[model samples]
Target: MSAAAPYAALSPDVVLAAVDAAGSWSDGRLLALNSYENRVFQVGLEDGGVVVAKFYRPGRWSDAAIAEEHAFAIELAAAELPMVAPLVIDGQTLLRHEGYRYALYPRRGGRAPSLESRDQLEWLGRLLARIHAVGSRERFVARTTLDRATMIQAPMRAALGSDLLPAHLFDAYRHAAGRVDDAVAQRFEAVGPVRQLRLHGDCHPGNVLWTDAGPHFVDLDDARTGPAVQDLWMLAGDEPMMDALLEGYGQFRDFDPGELALIPALRAMRQVHYAGWIAERWHDPAFPAAFPFAAEARWWEQHIADLHEIADDLF
Candidate 1:
């Protein structure tokens, strides 16, 4: 595999062989799942059951870090929450084959839960509070932390390096991004140090899968250390949703109303993060093919405008 196409050597034949190497016999039917950072697939088993196989992005995470993530999920599942942890085989959840790291999970099917439903929101809040209760028990020694530096500064550096960023917008982008970061920094300073815990870092509604039982999570690929609010803000897009979630969340753990102040800052950070992440990963074939907007200077101009708007709102 070349640096440009890291997964060029990871062909379908190798995927099937990886499964077999891990002691699971496949029926030779491999259906790719919707994932960009990592290659995930649904492989049919000899027993007619299917398992989800996730191949980690090379060089993105260390083996120890991945193992730590796996352990966190397994811990959450053990709490009887609706979290889907990796299936352990021969005392190993992380497996290696042909220089690629992978893991297996029981195939779970569920639809996206309705964030509009108060009842569903309340249920999710209760469970999320419980998740926080567990997450606060320990800390991640190897995972990422949600902060302006990693979320904003590092990404800005990556974007600066990408040639896709229009030369005309170079200074504009820098000025706009620096303003946003400064605003975010001031807000963080005002908020002081928040009590951060292990979080389902990307707890947006789409990541939530709902069944007749309730909410269950399948991917912890984005799990990291962050303020509890980071997990809540995405799922609770508005005040009413926040109320319903906090209503249930307060049932198990106390809600810090002060954390509410950080919402706008977080929103702006995420906006910058999306643009910067695209710029950083544009070299990946999937990114260029999937996000064609970044190639346009007009898009960058609009992004800078949005950043300016966000900065104005923050101050």
Candidate 2:
């Protein structure tokens, strides 16, 4: 078994046992949830109620960092923002059982928001503005910051160091990555003095759920300190969508138009980081099964070409 199969020992019996130990009565029902980085389950209680149990990936985050994530979710919920906070068991949101850290959340469900709709985009913008308002009120001392070093350079190094990139394509990948790095730095320098605040670091559409009431955000697992634009850009796919989002966002808080310049740079960083992330986790069994595309030399060729295009945009 590979080192990445840390959860191999975590069977359905163990999931039910862990939930039971956490003071929730389980009737031996467990359904695995779709997650790659961590193990999550929809556990059914004896009373017919269901709650989501999330087992944090071993060694991915420190206890302090997880606590910060939980705190941020709670803070957002307290402010009446549509965020799902963890269920507190015995006055603590985080719980440990048999050396595994876990948390339980009341199950909430909604469909993906239609970003194509201007009204929906504006509504999402308002919610994000409110979330950012609370995020600005404090700092995450233990969490990471989304910056060039962490998001770009670190991932680039991981990719360059890894054996996953075919030896023949390594030079091409490195050259394109270098250009991307240089361009990203120049863009950031151009957008000088952007404000940094705690944010839903991975605020893409998958993290949001929409219903008749409104949109609710889930999974603060990637929450960290960064420019507010990090939360907004992922939701806006085009110019009109961005304009609509900003229009609603401006209603709650003042937005700096300068941050708009960071979009291309941010997009480039995400592309590089995503590839690196998959490479870093390839040792894990789930990655290979889920991202079979990464195994192809042709994929790397296209990826390098895409990076070059991002560099062009940045230039």
Which is the leading candidate under lDDT?
2
lDDT of each: 0.90, 0.91
Off by over 4 Å in 2: none
Best by TM-score: 1
Clashing pairs in 1: none
TM agreement with the true structure for every prediction: 0.98, 0.97
Q: Write the per-residue lDDT of candidate 2 for residues 1-315, one digit (tens) a residue.
A: 136687877889888988898889999888998999999999999999999999998888899999999999999999999999999999998898877889999999899999999999989888889999999999999999998787888888888888888889999999999999999999999889898999999999999999888889999999989999999999988999999999999889989999998999989999999999888888888899999999899999999999999999889
Q: Give candidate 1 misplaced runs (Cα > 4 Å).
A: none
The TM-score between candidate 1 and the true structure equals: 0.98
Local lDDT at 36 for model 1: 86
Q: Against the hidden true structure, what lDDT does model 1 obtain?
A: 0.90
